[model samples]
Target: MSASRPLEGKVALVAGASSGIGAGIAEALAAAGADVALVARREAELTKVDAAVSAHGVRTLAYVADLADENVPQRAVDAAEAALGPVDILVNNAALARTGPIHDTAPRHWAQAFRLNLDVPFLLSRAVLPGMRERGYGWVVNISSEGSLLQAEWSAPYSITKRALNALTAQIDLENRHLGVRAVGICPGWVRTDLAQSPASLGVPEDELLSPADIADVVLWVVTRPSTVSVGPIIPVRPVSKSAQTVANWELYLREMRSYDTSGGHLIDLYGETR
Candidate 1:
């Protein structure tokens, strides 16, 4: 591998690549010379991102599909493999931002959140694991959230599913470590995406928000590290500004976590606010 283009021959499949962090990650991988497959529901946005990645002189494939279909994960992987080869890096960045008080949320909403936020990654990982194992090298990066640790009020679905994602990351690592695949979960705090800038995040400090590039840099570093370095963990990349609030809320967040219903979910709107 060239030092300037460590991922020169790598194939990376990034879900939720229509925009924001997903787009950023794809760009970073392409800059490192990785052929990229961008997957998301927006054909237009995917095409735009595909163009940007191709500018880096690497191969690019766009698979437009809503992962909520359950069957979409395998199909997405199949398409990527056919065009770009078996995935060397898989970034499970697709997520549903379901927000609502756990006690009053509906069961179907919960099901939807779990299906997208948790199940899709599990399905995608399953579809790609065999090839990665045979090749004896792969990275599965789960883009969890800082909310997973906070479990804040009125955000039950989002928080719990992400926490479960972190657990899934550990479970995947435990099972696949010996097979030469690594699973790393990243919990980013207040990324400066459109969602973070929405009215819902009113009191949030803009300057403290980490850029998608910040998260992408960390992911790139994680995947390129020597295999012997051991980097498969649920890492929390919180903004320093929010750390104190998280610490203060931890006790309350946990104490009341189990006292309410866990089946209701209110989905995030276009701007990422629960409506």
Candidate 2:
């Protein structure tokens, strides 16, 4: 453990770590000196993220599993504990969204969204509580969306589940803050994840949207806060845009895109690198 790293001896389990904000959080936690367990369904991408995390000189475990499955939460938590000791910080960053009016949406799609967005967090929190209670310290950071509060039209399923997730965070905090556990829900307006980079989202200035690192920084900050300063029923993070907004790096971006487009099948090797 390095003296400079506040989280030197802690262990962090990050859901959805194969890419996007999840990968960013895993790497950031490792850099802050926590052993990190990366969880996601893509083994290949998870391997890349694990390698990156290990570069920070902390232990890294890659858990490849679909958290949407009811049986996987316990299995993943058990495996992480076996490999890296008890998890001190749990980041629930995995989620799925289905868009459509409630009446038009398939029941199965709604169920899937709720399972991944809400139930998995609930199960993981339940699994980690006993250990946290015994040890007398733990942090659970739930990644939610602004839709949780906005109730966007045609996004009933995702909005409903995220709202429930925020509520769950409050309930967990109420139940466990007395036991040295801090639970909080973080809802960000728009983040520059893969889904947010679509043509439709590009019209908004990129600088106005949160980046993966932005969210990761928030996670790191939340977990490292002094215990005396209690944090959260729910926290909303809004991106503050820089004064100048322009795509001055478009040439570099296009060159990289061209390189990826021509990099043959090996381009798959770089999925987690950009984020």
Q: lDDT by residue for model 2 over 231-262, one digit each (tens)?
A: 87699876665321212222223334333232
**lDDT values for all models:** 0.83, 0.80
In terms of lDDT, which candidate is strongest? 1
How many backbone clashes does every candidate have?
Answer: 1, 0
- For residues 13-123, could you state the per-residue lDDT of candidate 1 as single tens digits? 999999999999999999999999999998998999999999999999999999889589999999999999999999999998877677777899999999999999999
Model 1: residues with Cα > 4 Å off, grouped in runs: 197-204, 242-275
User: In angstroms, how far off is 168's CA in candidate 2?
Assistant: 0.3
- Candidate 1 has which clashing residue pairs, if any? 105-264
How does model 1 score by TM-score? 0.86
Clashes of 1: 1
